[model samples]
Target: MTVPTPQAPRHVRAVAVQPHWSARDFTTPDAFRRWMRAQLEMARPHLRPGGVNLVVLTELNGLPLVLRGGGWALRLRTFERVALALFLARLPRALPVLLRERVSPIRALQLADIDANTELYLRTCRELARESGVYLCCGSAPMPRYARQGTVLRRAPGVLTNQTVLLDPQGNLIGVTDKVHLTPDEEAGGVDLTPGDLNELRVFPTPAGDLGVAISLDAFRADVIGSLAAQGCTVLLQPDANGAPWTSQEGLPPDPARVRDQPVAWLESSWQVTAQRQIPYAVNPMVVGNLLDLTFDGQSAITGPAEQAPSLRSYVLTDPRPGFLALAPWVTEGTPDELRQAGLDRAAHSGHPLENEYREDTLHADLTLPPATRPAPPRTPHEDALDALLRGEARAPRPGTWRAALPALPLLALPLLALALLRRRP
Candidate 1:
C-alpha cells in the first residue's frame, strides 16, 4: 500500500455559525436531516479555502452527522458519552458486516452517537483519516467526565472542562489543549477549570504554525486573546451557539448597556481576539447568553498595542495568514498615546465637569477636584421651623389644621374686626 503524504499547508478560514433554533427543537430523524442540510448549505460557501476548517458548535447531546456516499462522519460530537453510544450501538457491529459484504467505505455504513466509548471512537476516526484523506475535528464541551470518571453532576464543582483533539491525515492524534478560562458561574461553582498553561497551547501544531483551538466560547475574553497571542497562536477556533441579542431597546428586558463597560475595558486592554462560531448546541448558545456577544457589532473598534493586536491583514481568500493567526487588530498607523489624548479631548468637549477648558495657545491638562471638607450637620426640620417662628415669620400650620378651623377662625376674626371698627368710630 502506498503511504499517504501529509496534506499541504493551506490558508485557514473559519466562520462561526449559530444553527437555527428549529434544528434542535425537533426529535424526528428526518427533521434533523433537513436542518443539517440547510446548515451545510449556509456553511458550504465559507468552507471553500483549500485548508479551511469549520468549527461547528452545539450542545453536549446535539451533534449532527454528515453522510458521504459509502460511510458517514460525525460532526462536532464533543460529548464523550455520545461517542460511546455510537461505537456500541452502531460502528462496532456494522463495520465488520460491511467489510464482509465488500461495501464501499462511504456507502455501506451510517454514523451515530457513541457515548462512553471515547477510545473506540478515536480509533475509528484515525482509521477514517487514513482512508478518507480529510482532516476531521470534533468540537465538544469539556465536561468533567474526561477528567475523571463516574456520576458527575452538571452543577457540581469541578464538572466543567474545555478540551479539543485533532486527527491527522493518517488518523493519528496530533495535539490537544485544555481551555483556560471557565465561565464565572462555573468558577463560582468551584469547577476545576483554570487557564491552560502556556505549554499546553498546542492543539494546532501542524506545519501551519500553532493553531490553538478554543472550545465553547472562551475566545471572547480579553485575557484569553492576549494569552493566545503571547503564545504565538495564529488561529483561534471558536464554537458557539445562537443567543438572544445583547441589547434590548424596549424597556421590557434587562439592558446590556449597564454591564457593557466591563467588556469594553477588556477589549481596550487586549487587542488580538478573533473567534469563529462552531456547531453542536451544547455549550455554545448557553455560553453566548452568559458572556457578551463575540461578534463585533460595528459600534466601535478597539485600539491597543501593535504586537499584541489582531493581524492587520484583512480576511482575503487569496492571501490568508498562516496557522491559527491572531484575530485581534493592531493600530499600526495610530499610536495609543494619540488615541488617549483624543479620547480625553472628546470627553472635555462633551461637557465633562472635570475636563479643562481648551486653550488655543497651550495644551490643556486634566483638572483635579479639590479634597472635600466635611460640612457641619444639617439642622432638623423642627429646629428650622422653631427658628423661623422666633424670627417673627408666621409658622405654616400642619396640613390638616387649616381645613379643621376654617369656619370658626373666620367668624371670630370678623366679629373682632367689627368691634375694633366701632371703637375707632367713637
Candidate 2:
C-alpha cells in the first residue's frame, strides 16, 4: 500500500509582524486584545489576495497579562521584586495563593476572565478573516488552561503544555500545535512548560497547503526541521521570542558587511529554504518590546525559494534601525513533496545548509549543535545589566571613582589596625 502525495496551493501570501509590545501591553487582557486587533488592521493592505496569510508571534507572549489578571501573587512575583529577605519572608503567604491559582473556584473564575479575553481576540481575527477574505495563522499566544478528563489525554492536575493556535480565513481553528522544545532560559524565569507529544509535529492541512508549526528554539535544530520536512510540511510557521539585540554592536567601529547582513531584509533575500531543498516558503515573526530591562529586537522575516542565495549590493553602515521589515509580497508556488523529499535526502546525507545535525529525533533529545563563531557585538547598557542579572552577580562601578574607594577602605585599614594593636600589647 502507498500513501498519496500531499499537494501545495498555487499561491500563498505570508506576513510576518514585529509590532511594539511592552510591559505596558500586559496591563490588562483587553488592552492586549486591542493591540493584536490593531496589528491585524495594520497588515490589512499587505495581505495576499485570496492567499494564505502566515502570521507568527512570540512564544507564551500573552502570559504576563494573564498572570497579572490573577490579582496579586503573579504580579508581585513578576514585576515588583522585594529584597531577598522580604521575598523569602512572604513565601508562606505567596505559596498558598500560587497553588490556589491552579485549583478550584479560583481557576474557573480566572479562566473565565482570560478565556473570554482570548475569545474576543479570536472572534476579532475570525471577523477580520471573513472581512478581508484571507487565511490567517493568527500569532501563537499561550494560555495556562485547565483541561478536564477528555479524549486529548488523561486528566491532569490543571496546567498543560503551551499550544500554538491558528485561525483560518473564515475565523475557525485550523490547527493546535503544542511547542515541543521549551527554552531553558524561560524555565529559569519560573514558567515550567511541558513539552508536547512528538506526534503533534505532523502537518495540518490548510487552504494554503500543509502547515507545520515550530515554536522558537525548535527551529534552531536541524533535526527538528528535518522531521517537519519528512512529514510533508509544505510551509513552516516559526513563532519566535528572541531577545538578542540585532544591532548589539553599539560602541566599537562596526563592519559595514555585518550591519548590512543583520536585517529582516537580509534574511528574506538570503534565506531561500527551497535552495536548501526544504520548505518552499517560511514566515518567522519575532517578539518586540522591553520587559523588566530586557529589550527585544524586532527582526521578523520572510523567506522563499531562490535559484541560489543572492549577493546583494552592500551599503554603508550608519545607524541601522530595526522595525517591521517587509519583502515584496508575492504568491508561493510548487508542491512541497519534492521540496520535502529533497530535504529528507539531504538529511540522510549531511548536506544540510545550516551544518546542523541532520537526523530524526523524538519529541525531546539532547541535540549536538555546532558552536557559533559569529562576530560578537558590543552589549548595550541594558544588555550589560541583563547579563549581570542572568549571572547573579554585582560589581562596584568605576574603579577610579571615590564611590569605589568606599568598599576598599576597610581592607586598606585592616593591616594597619593589626600592627597598632600588636605594638600596644607589647
Candidate 3:
C-alpha cells in the first residue's frame, strides 16, 4: 500500500512586532534567549522574502542588573557613579557582556533609556550589532533635576549621556541623532545640561527605505511633521520614556492623549499635502508590564505618493496571539517632486490664518523666484575684509598688538610679581 506525502506549509508575508517590554525581565540570559526564540517561533510562519522583523525593546533599565548579575545589587545606591566609573575604566570588558544578554529575533531594535546610561548603552549596542545581524537604535535624554513640585537632582548632566543610535549587523554606526526637545523640567536646568536644538533632523538610509526618525517628544508638532514629510521620511519612531501621568490618570490608564493626537495629526497633514503618510509608533512605558495590558494607540500604516489615495491600516494586539504588523514592501525611487511642492504649499499656508490682508502678498511671494543670472564685480578693501572674516581670519583692531599680547602678558606678569615681592620685603 502506498502512503500519501504531506505537503510543506506555505510561506506568508512577514510582519514586525513592537513589543513594549524589557529583555532583562527574564531572570537568566538563557531565559531571555528562550523568549527571543519563542518570539521567532510565533513570527516564523509569517516570514516572507524581503520582509523585515523590527522589535522595539522597551524597559531596558534593568540591563545593568542583567549583564552584571546580582553583583549590581551591591552598588545599587551608587549605580550611576559606579556604572560610569566602571564603563570608563573597563569598556573593553563591559561591551561583550551586554551583547550576550539582550536577545531578540527582530531585524532592527530600538532601545530607550535615561541619559546616564547612554554611553554604556551605545557601546553595548555597537558590540551587539557586530555579533548579531540585527540593527540597533537608541534614544535618550538628560534626566530632569526637578519634578513638577520642586528641585530634584538628577546625577548625570550634559555628558553625551542621553542618545539614540542605530547599529548595523557588523556593529558599525549607521546613524546617530540626538533628542531635540526636552521635557519641561529637563529644559529648566534640572539636570545641569543645555537642551539640544529641536531643528536638527536626519534621515537614515536602510535596506527597508530612507527611514526618517525624529528624536523629540514634540515631533508631533504639525510643522515638524510637515518638514520631515517634505524631506521624504516615511517611518517616524517616537520612543518616549515619559511614564506616570502621561500613561495613566487617576489609577486608570488608557492610551495617552498626546500619543493619540500626534499620530492623527501626522496622518491628516501628510495625507492632505503629498499622500506620503507616515507610519508612527509610540513606544511607551519604557518598562516591563503585561503585554496584554499595554496598548499601542497610534495607527500602524503605510502611505504612498500623492497620486495614490491614502490607505489606513491598524494593528492592535488585543490578546497574546504573537503576530506581527505586515507592511507593504518598499522600493526606493527618485525624490518625488510632489513632496517639494507639498512642502512649499504647507509653508505658504502656515502664515496667520486670521490675516486676510496678506493673502495677495503671500500668493505673490510663493510664485516669485530669484533671477538666475548676475554680474561679477571687483572686490574692494571692505569686501576683502568681509571675505577675510568669512574665512575665519582674526580681525583685531590692531592685528600685531592682539597677536603679541599672549607672549607679552606672561613676561609682564613675572616682573610685576617680582617688583611686588621686592617691595613686600620691607
Candidate 4:
C-alpha cells in the first residue's frame, strides 16, 4: 500500500522577519502584547487579503517576554545577571517549585511565572494570526510543553524545552515543534534545556504546503531534516537566533580548507540541506540586537533548492553567495570591502560600547515551487536510533554514526563567555 503525496498550492507569499531583540520593560501584559503586535505590523504591507500568506519570526524572539515585570534590570548589560537577579528577587515564590520539581533556579524561576508568560505568548500569536489573516510561525521560547486539558491550557510536568508554535488564520495551533538539538550553552550553561523528542516532529498542512520546522540547531541535523522531508514536508521553516557576531568566525568552520564568515557556516543548515534533500522552499528568520549581554545577529532570508530557478531576487551577502528568494537588509548594509572602508565592520565586532549593528525588517517573496521531480527517500535506521535515543531506549551508538559526528557539526554556537559573576543588587 502507498500513501498519497502532500501537495502545495501553486503560489505563496512568504514573509521572513528580522526583529531587533532588545530587552523591554513589560510592566504589564498589554505592554508585551503591544510590542509583539508592532513587530508583526512591520509585515502588514506584504499581506494580501484573500491570498495564502505566511509570516515567519526568528527563534527565541518570544524569550524576552519572560522579562515581563523586569524593571531597572531590563537596562542591565547581560541576561545571566538579570536572570539571576530575577531568580533571587522571586526566590520566596520560586523555592517551592524548585524543591518540588528538583530543578535549577533558572527552571524554577520560569515555572514560577510560566502561567502568565505562556498565556501572553499564546494570546499574542493567536490575535496576530486572526487579525492578519496569515499563517504565523511564532518564534521559539523556553517553556514547558503545553496542551489544552479540557478548557485549561496546562503544561506538562517536565523541564522546559525550546518550542516553536504554528497558528492558522483562525487562531488555532496547527503545528508545534521543539528543538531536537541544543547549543552547548543551552545544555550545560545556565539555560539547562531539555532536548526534544525526535519522533514528535510535526508537519503542518497549510495552503502554502505541508510545513516542517527545524528550530535553529535542529536544521543542521540530517536525521531531523530528512525525517520531515520524508513525511512530505515541502516547505522548511527554520526559526533561529544566532547569539554571536554575524561577522565573527566561530565553531567548526563550514569549509575545512579555510575560515569563512558566520553566514557561510549558516548556509550548510539552511539552503544547503534543503537543496540536497530536494525540499522545494525554505525560510529562515533570524533575531538580532542584544538582550542584555547575549546578542543575536544574522540576516534573515528565504530560498529554494539551488537547482531550481530563482523565484525571489533580493540578496544580502555577495561573498560565498547562494540564490535567495528574499533576504533582509543588514544593519551594516554593504559588501565586506564597503564595510571595511566604512569601519563599521570593526565597530560591529568591538567589545567596548554596546553595538547597534542590527536592523528590523521584513522580507517577502511570492514563491511557486516546481513540482517534486523525485520521491523523498524513506526514514533510515540512524534516524530511528535518534528517535530511540530521545525515548531513552537505544543502546550506545557505534563508531562513525550520528553520535560520533555530532561533535564536529556547526551547532549555531551561542557565545556566552562574557557572563558576569552573579552579584546580588543592594
Task: Please name the candidate that would achieve the greatest TM-score relative to the true structure.
Answer: 4
Sort the candidates on lDDT, descending order: 4, 2, 1, 3
lDDT of 1 by residue, 333-401 (tens): 234345334333323123444232211110001111112222322433322332233233323221112
TM-score of each: 0.37, 0.56, 0.40, 0.78
Instruction: State residue 309's C-alpha deviation in candidate 3, in Å.
Output: 12
lDDT of 3 by residue, 1-426 (tens): 999665432221212322333324333444444443443343344333343323223222323322233334333323233333333333233322223323110100111122223333444444444444444443333321211111212222212213455445555555544555554433322222244444555555444334444443545456555555555553454444332211112221263443332323333322232232343222221221221112122222222332322333422211111112222211111243442232223221223332111110000000011121222223333223322322234231210112322343344453443333233210
* lDDT scores in order: 0.32, 0.46, 0.32, 0.68
Off by over 4 Å in 1: 1-10, 22-41, 49-137, 144-160, 168-172, 185-199, 207-209, 220-223, 242-244, 248-258, 261-271, 274-426
Worst 10 residues of 4 by lDDT: 417-426
Count of clashing pairs, candidate 4? 1
For residue 366, what is the lDDT in candidate 1? 12
Error of 2 at 325 (Å): 11
Report the lDDT of model 2 for residue 371: 24
lDDT of model 1, residue 247: 23
Judging by TM-score, tell me the better candidate of 2 and 4.
Answer: 4
